[model samples]
Target: MNPLLDERKATVEADHQWIANLEVDERARTGIPLLKVGFNETFGYYISISRAKADQVPANYIRKQTLKNEERYITPELKEREARILTARDDLHKLEYEVFVTLREEVGEQAEAIRHLSRAVAAADVLCGLAELAVYQGYCRPEMVNGRELKIVDGRHPVVEQSLPAGFFVPNSTELGNIEETSPLPDLIILTGPNASGKSCYLRQVGLIQLMAQIGSFVPAKSARLGVCDRIFTRVGAVDDLATGQSTFMVEMNETANILNHATSRSLVLLDEIGRGTATFDGLSIAWAVAEYLAMEIRSRTIFATHYHELNELAGMLPNVANYQVTVKELPDQIIFLHQVQPGGADKSYGIEAGRLAGLPTVVIQRAKQVMGQIEKHSKIAMGLREGL
Candidate 1:
């Protein structure tokens, strides 16, 4: 364009006349006119007509757009001029684009070096952020090892606790791997508690701490001795994936099966309500067997949170299985969530109590309590039979 020849300049000048001044009615000063011409990016060129004078438009006019008060048309002569102008503009643009693509390819020759530098910078940036987080959050450096012994003292959920009132987020501890003289493998925690307790948060916090430690980042713990895990599997909650044609129970079972299939002793598994998605007896049986397999066959460090209080019996039956509960303090009329994790099994799930606390209808609460009592009585008898007592 800078040094175009005489012929090219003359051709460029001729092309400009194509769209320079589209035809319009000079009678527009008085009122809306029937015939007019316009050019825009969308339709390129069109003739406008007012409904009152639409009959005066030429028969050769091709209707392109219709409006409430008027219609737009394109004539053959206008269309031919538009096509020529557009073709010339497109050719110029394509030539420029080709030049740009060639230049881009020359720069792409150095793409490999750029990508390596980018990865290094990204890693450095992540480390800088982690270091800042450690300093601000009072995180301590974790001691990482390979041979079992997963321990974390006073560990807090990094994100969950930050939003809580200061010192309100309870710091819990975790200990896995059988250190006993006669034991065969690591221990599995059977976590049980009422709804809305810190059981889920505690489970996630343990996994997060271990993951952070293994990745060479300081963890949100007073002290941590982490065992390097090959994989960290978590099945926390369920939802019906109807679009995928799977029920809530099916989704839960699939995820549970995946964990059971691939998880090794070196893996860390956090299972929340393994079989609560299905029928009571079926769910309980599956959950009970899954825990046993994890403890005996896979021997992985696992935190199993559940609403099934009956699963607590695993502590007595399996040596590698231990029980833990998120304790709640009962008030005169309301139960306060303590959010504390402590040793031993829970006496009750406190679901009805929790519903009552959540402002459930008084009549419903009373009926639930009555039904729970009947269920418990029958469950105790069934349990005795299962134990052959």
Candidate 2:
């Protein structure tokens, strides 16, 4: 569309090629195969020759620079070519900017129409992509309702399922609140299990299903009936924000506080390892209090995934709170993660087994087990004393 730009670009390229050709001819004429043509800001296009070949330079090569082991020289022809090349670049830039301004003005005339068409195209692209995903991945349309009920039968993680082979990613079901004649489920689910038993994945799955349903897209489930939520809040994983001068624990508490302050009965909250960055008892205590608050005060649909098995007591105390665990098959030497979330609270986290599977040294693993045993013994005694007191 711009002939001036094309012509200027060709001129620049041809000038550069001329310098390269000049170097090749000079190398052959002077019998210096190591001669190179280069350009720097301080010294415009110059031919570099090693000190050993200083005597071999042609008479027309005027010395421009002297390095530790090389001498740079520029011929009169090369100097003139350099000036043209440099000026042509500046002219090219100015011409390009002028052309750009002209094109931009032309585009600006139809800016409204362009924006309208762009919005339509973008919407169609998104819808087509989602429809394709639904067809290929066997996603089911969710039945959204006005009431506070979320039910999914055999739901899978949208992203994780795709990464695995077909039918490899296990699907799990979730039910909360009452729908029609169905019995009411808990508002808050206390999810506990071993270190790598898919508790976090299950929590994320529920949140994603709810989000996908609300966005008018088919969810990655065999069947689902979801209620529209005002907001979906998540506090997952621990990462210290050093730039903001906040530790991992501080970040966790800040997010938790935000969820508690703003979340309502119509909100969906997904929390994972809420207070594991602090001391064991401190973390457990905070997790317990957070779960209780979400169940009682906020009354939000929550999936609290934590290693604190003690929080399972909330299910016993709170009517709106329930307990779920990612089941595992314990073997003699190791544990197999079932990746199945079922109703019940796990008594053990099996952290040492996880560490062992992660390839910790035998001595370290044994020492960890010993320490764990002692801690459990002391915890039981402490509980007994507290109960008595």
Best candidate according to lDDT: 2
Write model 1 residue lDDT over 1-389, tens digit each, in one string.
32333444455467666545445332353244545667789998887878777766666778899889988888787788777777766665666677678778987999999899999999999999999999999999998876788989999999998898888888998899765557543379999888888888998999899888988899999999887899999998778898999999999999999999999988999999888877888988898889889998999999999887777888877788899999999877778889989888887888898787789999999999899889777767337635852
Candidate 2 regions off by >4 Å?
A: 1-99, 178-182, 381-389
- Model 1 residue 187 lDDT? 73
Clashes of each: 0, 0
Q: How much is 163 displaced in model 2, in angstroms?
A: 1.7
Runs of candidate 1 with Cα error greater than 4 angstroms are 1-99, 180-186
Give the lDDT of residue 63 in candidate 2: 93
lDDT of 1 at 252: 90
TM-score per model over all chains: 0.74, 0.75
Q: What's the TM for model 1? A: 0.74
